[model samples]
Target: MAKIWVFAEVNNGKVDTAALEILTKARELGGEVEAVALGPGSTDAAKELGQYGATTVYASDDEVYADYVAQPAAHALHELVKEHAPELILFATNYDSRDIAGRLSARTGSTLMSNCFDILGTDKARTTIFGGATVVDVALEGTPKIALVRPKSFEPEASGGEANVMPVEVDIPDDLKKAKRVERHEEQASGPKLEEAPIVISGGRGLQDASNFELLDQLAGAIGNAAVGATRAVVDAGWVPYAYQIGQTGTTVKPGVYIAFGISGATQHIVGMKGAKTIIAVNKDEDAPIFQIADLGIVGDALKILPQLIEEIKTRKG
Candidate 1:
């Protein structure tokens, strides 16, 4: 069987959702799927990969990876890839994964595909272009094909098994450790994370005023387990922090339910949220582009309707 490797990123002593998503998809390719977990909390993260379909996990709990930037991790991964010679390596579309994948691609001179959302077996992967208006399938040539997959592209499923945890040690050369991470700060957020939330209520220019976002908060509160998101325009206008922005340049979300308020559906914005299972759009103009893809479209003022929607939800719960 072909060998496939996934770079499992660890966060707060657990495996990130993106890694599990890739692992779930990789197992379907009929390959012997393995994983590499590095940095702090990697041991704990590695332990969870088996249920998600990783047959083996190369784990390193050393703080050296967390202390330095991507260089140390990239160099170590390069060595492992050379020694193991896996046919494919998968990476999540995150900051650290992007850095490591790019560096590894250069080191190995292998075929590298970025921003991929789907993999068609071991020979090809699919991605979007022209702001997600066009879909392109890329051929995986060369010995060890590398792909950086976008999050939320696939659902994660557990196989109810345990991976063989293999402890590994790699010496980082002095030069590769030049860039050191001095400090890390986590963004404080209340409620469910936007990408992981089951229901996402997003506001755009139609909200009229930034202060009106309180309406979204109230609706989210009433709905329960919902997160608020905003378009790039609102984020650029400082209506919300960049962390709350959802679009091509921001977070991509694939929630079960996506409600858009006054968003005109710019191509860049659509690229990020089109993966949502269900889309409900509200706007004043019936001819808005968002109506084209929305499963349900409302021609009205979002600001005026939000209060009524919030009250109805509250009433239903009561």
Candidate 2:
């Protein structure tokens, strides 16, 4: 039987949703789920992981774990894996997770599968694919296999009862100790997370001016619970923050409804949002590439169409 290890991420004492998603899948694999949380105040963090099906939660509470740097956290997880000898390791496919996954793979000589959307199993091994396309099946050649799972790929399953939290003590590796976090900075924004939002309203070059984004905000607000997204061009033009950008080089979103206002639908952008359940495009150019994949398309200026759409939604709501 292979025991599964999941990295439970915490920042400012708040647990990330990605950790819950990984534990949910770990349970489905029929393996013993163990979660590792490394931070200054991680006791409460570890307990939260238990509510989501983690059988054993390892909490590392040390000053070295105070920062969210990837190296120290990876070292802590590496130590836990050495002691427990888990058959598989799981991580969320975020920027920090990618760094930690790479470091851990190099340390343990484990096979790495990154950005896996689905895990298929035959009696022999597990398989996953990348880019929401191309299926590659892999059987581990080593004792433990590691996989970085994409967020929003799987729905989290809540544990019916309380979870068991265990505190594990391990000496921090010297190599990781050498690297310390001197400063921490965060970009504060108020809104729903783009990946978690039910509806996403995005704009492209067709909008022409950065100030025109207020139209998108208006439409998004009308939709209620909609998030604003932008194309690479718009982001490069400084129309929106990089976090709101969606494309091959940006965040991949799978919202229930994706509304593209004035976007031309480059393949790079299309691939990122192709997983959306419904796509609607508003552009004057009927030949815009976005129309090919859009479920509904309007041939008009987005600036004009957006306000009308917002009014219609408001009227319907009332």
Candidate 3:
């Protein structure tokens, strides 16, 4: 039986959804699925990985990795791969995973396929091309191949099992920690994060300016469990942070409900949100390209409609 190794990323003592998603699919591949958890919450993340079908969890939360040494993390992963010799190694598309996967690919001499949504057979994976207009199949040759799976690409599940946690420690070369973290600045984020939110209200250039995004914020507050998102134009114009961007160059969202206000639905923008279950577009132009894919197209000014809509929703709930 071919063994599969999944590197699980931990955030605030929880296993990242992307890591759980890949682990669920890894079980479907009919093999021994082992997970590697890193960082401060490695212990908690290992248990969560086990619940998602990871049989053996190699945990490394030693000071070198806990301190966030990217190079040492990559080195430790290389050493594990050299010892275990798993056929397939999976990673999430997050920053740290991409960094480690790239370096490990170079170290192992195995090609790394990034931005994959699905894994086919054991070695082949499926990815999108041409701004998500085309489907491409990629098959890797040789052992210990790496695949970086996109976030929210698969469903996360729990199998109600416990993992055999194995502690892994590696020596960190002195030169690798040359870069030290000076300070970490975080924006004040409210409500559910955009990527994981089931309902998203996104605005584009049509909102006019940064202050206009308040309309979306108010609506999101009223709608309950909704996250506000922004188009590339608005993000580039500094109306919102890049974290709120949903477009070809930004996050790929497949929310249950997607409401677009003032968005023209350019091909670039559509690539990111086309997978949504229901799309509602509000634009002044009846001929807006956004209407082409929208399940409900409203031809009107959003500014005027939103206030009334918010009031009506509040009244109905009351």
Pick by lDDT: which candidate is best? 1
lDDT of 1 by residue, 1-318 (tens): 899999998866878899999999999998999999998898777768998999899999988888888898988898899789899999998888998899999899988999899999787999999878889998989979999999888889998879998887899888887888887777757999999899999999999899999999999999999999999999999999888889877789999999999999998899899988999999999999999999999999998899999999889999
Q: lDDT of each model, Cα atoms only?
A: 0.91, 0.79, 0.87
**Could you arrange the candidates by lDDT from highest to lowest?**
1, 3, 2
Model 2, span 152-232: residue lDDT tens: 667888885455777767676676666567876667446788887889999999998999899989888888898999999
Q: Using lDDT as the measure, name the better of candidate 1 and candidate 3.
A: 1
**TM-score for each predicted model, relative to the true structure:** 0.93, 0.87, 0.93
Q: What TM-score does model 1 achieve against the real structure?
A: 0.93
Cα TM-score of candidate 3: 0.93
lDDT of 3 by residue, 113-153 (tens): 98898999679999888767799999899988999888777
Off by over 4 Å in 1: none
Model 1 lDDT at residue 83: 84
Question: What residue pairs clash in candidate 1, if any at all?
Answer: none
Candidate 2, 268: how far from true, in Å?
3.8
Residue 210 displacement in candidate 3 (angstroms): 0.2
Candidate 2 lDDT for residue 214: 90
